[model samples]
Each structure stands twice: as C-alpha cells, then as structure tokens.
Target: MDNIFKSAMRGALFFAAACLLLWGIVPEWKSVCAGLLLGAFASFMNALLLRRRVEIVGQAMANRGMRKMGLGLGSRIAMVLCVAMVAYKYPETFNLPATLAASMVMPFILLVSAFLHHKRH
Candidate 1:
C-alpha cells in the first residue's frame, strides 16, 4: 500500500508540473492548464488524506480499540467541491470540465501502480 501511494504521489506531482509547464508555454490555454493544475493538486491531497485515514483505522483495529472509522469521503468530496467553486468563480482562469477530469487522475495512477505491484509480487 505504501509503495502504491508513493508511486501515485510521484506520478501526480509529475503531472502537475507538466501542467504548469504547459500553462507557461501556451498562454491561450491558460484556463485549461490552470484548472488541471488545481485539480491535480486536489487529487494528490485527497489521496494523502485517504492514506492517512486508512493507516489510523488499521492501527486502531490492531489495538482492538472500538472507535468509529471512515475513509474521509466527506472531506474529499468537500475538497472537490471547493475546487469546482473556484473554477466557477473564475471561469476565465480555470476550465470547469478540465478541473473535474483532472481531479480523478490520481486514482487511476494509484490503480495502475497497484496492478504493477501485484504482477511483480
């Protein structure tokens, strides 16, 4: 799991940097690139939040502690909502559709990493 997370994080960061480069190189596509950058950042954060929550839950379960646990779905949703709101608020600065699409990139990266890890092991 940690390996998956680390690889995903690296991929996400690389993606975000690429988007930033594109934004600088193409002034006409600034909105799209900015939106993608924002979404990629949010996606990375969402993955980190989920990973931390999972670790906490695993620790609690191992210790036999009876505490309610959740995967922080609400927080992740809220984070996405905030991104959407930002895009909506500044349509010229960010493309809404691109932002939404980029927001899902991290999960795909993580999935690919998991598949590769499974095949290797």
Candidate 2:
C-alpha cells in the first residue's frame, strides 16, 4: 500500500478514537463529535487530493491533461467553500469552533499518522 494512504488511515483512526474518548467518555465534548466527523471526512478527502496531485506531478502530464488538472483544483476549492458554508449556516449541527479546530488539526493528523505508520514498519 502507498505510504500516504496508510498514513491517512491511521489519521482517521486516531481522530475517531480521540473523538470517541472525548465524546463518549467525556461529557464536556459530547456535542463536538459531529464537527469532528466532518473535519475527519474533509481530511480524508484532502489526503486523496494530495495523493492525486502527487500522481499528477509524478506522471508529469503534458498540456493535454492540464485542463483536467485545473478542474480538479477548482473542485477542491469548491469543496472547501461548501464545508465552510455548511458549517456557517448550520452552527448548531456543525459547531463552528469545533469544526475550525478539526480543520486546523487535519494536516497535523496526516503527518503524525504517516510517521507512526512508517515507524511501525
């Protein structure tokens, strides 16, 4: 399996475990799980995006594929905007602070997950 994917899986597991610990066990953070889940999903999508980008750069596609590349990038941006809009419009369900916090920690999760996965092997 690709190292990046392994890392992403680890990150998702870690996030889920942490969320369960906090929301299931700790009453204070019970309401934040929804946002946390959204954030985790976003992070997973981001990882896939990164992997695709790596593949694109790795292949060194010619001008013909550049349009597809641009479209992909545009779609990613749209996803980001949608996430923001959803969280903003539905704060009760999404929890702004928690969602933002999750968004911020996504990259960190990716890195830590990758590192731990690498270390285990």
Alpha-carbon TM-score of each model against the true structure: 0.92, 0.71
Candidate 1 ranges with C-alpha deviation above 4 Å: 69-71
* Per-candidate count of clashing residue pairs (backbone under 3 Å): 0, 0
Model 2 poorest 10 in a row by lDDT: 62-71
Candidate 2's TM-score: 0.71
lDDT tens per residue, model 1, 1-121: 8887888788888898899899889999999999999899889889888888888888889999986666499999999999999999999999999999998899999998899889999
Model 2: how far residue 46 lies from native, Å: 1.2
Q: How big is the positional error of residue 27 in model 2, measured in Å on the Cα after superposition?
A: 4.7
Mind giving the per-residue lDDT tens digits that candidate 2 earns over 54-107?
777666665345533446666665666666677888877776667666655667
> What does each candidate score in C-alpha RMSD?
1.5, 3.4
Per-model lDDT: 0.90, 0.69
